[model samples]
Target: MTKADLVENVYFRTGFSKKESAEIVETVFELIKQTLEAGDKIKIAGFGNFIVKQKATRRGRNPQTGEEIEISSRKILTFKPSQVLKNAINEGAN
Candidate 1:
């Protein structure tokens, strides 16, 4: 779902005005962004974890030219869903 959908969900669930719900949703997203920027992980029970991982520089081959290229090191964010969430999703799929 898009951000607007989240805002609408918040508005309905919390009895807040649309503007307030939007602000609340935006604030939550901003906080998550800041946390990830700081290289911190976020863990939500029964949901998943947001983790930042570091990768070292490596060599890779360009598919088209068949030339060797250096891959720069970088930090990446990854998510691992909790077992409870996995089970819930599987249950729904069945």
Candidate 2:
């Protein structure tokens, strides 16, 4: 779902005003972004871990032109879900 949906869900579950819920969600997102930008990991129990990984430069091809290119190194974000989250998803399928 989108951020608006998340804010609405938070408002309903926490009995908070829509504005407050939005602020809370925005703040959480900002914090996560800042943490990752600072090269740190964030682990939320029962959810997952957010990690930043550095990738080295690699050779790549331009699909359209069939030309070879060098892909620059970059930092990427990754998520590893907790077992609890995996179990919940599996349970819903049954």
Candidate 3:
């Protein structure tokens, strides 16, 4: 769901005011963003882990021009779902 949807969900679930729900969602998102920016990982039980990984510079070819270029190093965010989450998703499919 989108951020607005999240806020709405929170509002309905918690009986919080719409403005308060929005703030809660925004605060949670801001906290997550700040943690990622600090190169730290976030792990939630029965959910998933948010990890930041570093990728070194590499050579890559331009798809259209066929020109080789250097791809700069960067920090990437990745998520690994917990086993519980995986099982829940699989069960839903069945």
- Candidate 2 per-residue C-alpha lDDT over 1-94 given as tens digits, one digit per residue, 9 for 90 to 100: 9999999999999999999999999999999999999999999999999999999999999999999999999999999999999999999999
lDDT score, candidate 1, position 56? 97
Best by TM-score: 1
- Residue-by-residue lDDT tens digits, candidate 3, 69-88: 99999999999999999999
TM-score of each: 0.98, 0.92, 0.95
RMSD of 2: 1.1
Clashes of each: 0, 0, 0
For each candidate in the order shown, give its overall lDDT on alpha carbons: 0.98, 0.98, 0.98
After superposing candidate 2, which stretches have Cα over 4 Å from the reference?
A: none
In candidate 3, where is summed lDDT lowest over 10 consecutive residues? Answer: 1-10
**In model 3, which regions exceed 4 Å deviation?**
none
What TM value does model 2 have?
Answer: 0.92
Clashing pairs in 3: none
